[model samples]
Target: MQVELGQKIIDKIKADSLSPKPRWHFLVREWLVWMMGALALIVGAASVSVMRYLAENSSWAVQAPYGQTFAGWLLLSLPYFWLFLLGLFLWLFYYNLKHTKRGYRYPMIYVAGIALFGSILLGLAFYTLGVGSAIDGVLGRKAPLYAHVFNPHIDFWSAPEEGRLAGLVVAHVEGEDTFRLIDRKRGEWIVTYNPRDDIFVVVGQPLRAMGTISGEQSFEAVRIMRMRPGREYFQRFGPTVISVSGSGMHRNK
Candidate 1:
């Protein structure tokens, strides 16, 4: 009888050891959170790279300065904003998964609270960054303009003749700063600088001008306007009529 009883006890122990254990919902939840965190990190890195590239290379030689300014605005507002949001979500997801598994059952009110708090922080940050400046420009509180300056450092074209004007300011506009120029025949043309008065170019400075027929001209009226430095002297709605080749200045109208 003793031998039989010892064998029964040993069998019970073996059965207990071999039996399948119940799944821990918390472990699964933690794994999912980790996956999400990895994804967010990858996306954030990609976003940073793209934003940097756009900020640096978005414009032609003359347009580079203005492009950089606009890129700064974008970096402050869009890319960072999205990155913060992603981080917030990742944090909340992790918190929920961790706390819930620890046998602490809390309502989702905590998560909602956290999200609200994060959004408020993001709003405050945006307000501090001069995003309001863009809004003000739209509201007409300030006139927004873009300026491009020629860079003598880079080679833009393959043709030797085209190289003469490579670093020269090609086309500039004040009222319409975002205008694009295209060659109808070759579809190749250089972008010139278009600086805003308040932002890039200063007042009382000679503005540079270059054209296909006209080599280049430096004039005094090129002084940046106190209020609208990038705007042309005439303040016309369309392209201004500045002297391209001759000593005389004439309006396109």
Candidate 2:
């Protein structure tokens, strides 16, 4: 009687084990693929919109205000986001091949291919913009310079009550190494050097400053474009002045 009871218990355990269990792995894999695909579609749409807006607006610089709109965000997020999706897809594909008997590897590969293609395209788009310049600056290929300069005459005591005062660097400040530009009418405006490209000027040969200005300051030239380093040529229409203030300078330690 005890032996029969033991056999009965074993049979029950086997039956329970043979009962179908939920395929949690398959469900998770499907969910991940769906989420990644949705993100890719959204980013793709945003990229198209930004590209169109930029094309229509000729004055829109890569560092312009509207540059960070939805389109810009999409371009910036695309590569990394898609690469993440690709990794997920690859993992799911491998898991399905190993554990599940389903022939879903091909579908996973297809999804990964789409993600890879999107990442490459978005990366290319980003590089075409000022991203390349930023990378160059990071690698020390280009020296950083203050984009805007303030006139030297304007004193902070009697600076403009409203509106921005900015100019190009006429000389470097002795102690601070700051660029000195004169807002001849207002006085002198001093802008400190910024390290990051985000708030700072774009990285290039001589560097350019593009930002807004407000408050009182001295500035002879409203804006100076692309002032070359160690050169004294002023008002030659060399580069277009971007803005009136050093508000665009960004510094990150």
Candidate 3:
């Protein structure tokens, strides 16, 4: 009885193998797999671009002049949409590849690893090409969420009475130790510098000044430094940092 059962199973397999398969079936499957891969790569790079954009524009660059912690910086990056999208695309990549021929031979972990690695490599290339900045510019102009989600909370930085102000320096006040500073919210402040510190103020530079709010739109800066981009962003949004309340400010005296 066992021998008969085995012979019957072998004969059925042979019969199935001899059946003609539709030529278009394989072609369609291959096409779908390729399409999914292409899409996965696109979204993967887009995710990286989002991170790069936020890193460039975050307030930490303006406030923290010195070094910052990596883990802290990573925590601040949560609100941005890219990190979520990256994970989503990676999963999609794994799903698409799994349906392809021979894909089942590899474990899910292997597939996911390959997807993540490919995405990261593609993402870096997109960031280097300024794809992230271009996307941000578009979103900033068209999407209100751009400001709502990614922008740093301003009430903390607007503490003019606490001797701190954040903004872009739009102009110099003649030969005086002052320049026009525009905060992320577009609020303008008069930033005065300590003459002895030799702090340089250039027009249109992003800056954070520490002192007191002298007027409705004025702030006095006792110290200043050229803002470095990525670190400042992490400082502003990082987890341990509840508010950007001059936590990174330095005194020149």
State every prediction's TM-score relative to the real structure.
0.26, 0.25, 0.62
For the record, the alpha-carbon RMSD of candidate 3 to the native fold, in angstroms, is: 10.5
Model 1: worst 10 consecutive residues (lDDT sum): 146-155
lDDT by residue for model 3 over 1-253, one digit each (tens)? 9999999988998988766579898989888997997798789877776676556534555445424355554455444456678888888888888878877899988888888878878887888897775676565445554444544333334456666565555555445766656565556566768875335565544555566767777676776655433223322222221111123322221
lDDT of 2 by residue, 1-253 (tens): 9999999988998978765557997688767756655555445433333332223212224324433565654443243433444456445434434333343545766655554555446545754664433432332222222112111111211123322232334444233424545432424455444433322223211323344343344222233334222112122212334333334433222
Order of candidate numbers by lDDT, starting with the best? 3, 2, 1
Name the lDDT value of residue 108 in candidate 2. Answer: 66
If candidate 1 were superposed on the true structure by all CA atoms, what would the RMSD be? 16.0
Counting clashing residue pairs in each candidate, in order, gives 12, 32, 8
The local lDDT score (0 to 100) that residue 78 gets in candidate 3 is 48
Could you tell me the lDDT of residue 137 within candidate 2? 30
- Residue 229, model 2: Cα distance from true site in angstroms: 26
Off by over 4 Å in 3: 1-22, 57-74, 77-79, 151-164, 173-175, 194-215, 222-253
* Cα lDDT tens digits for candidate 1, 132-185: 333322322223321111111111221223322211222334443321222212
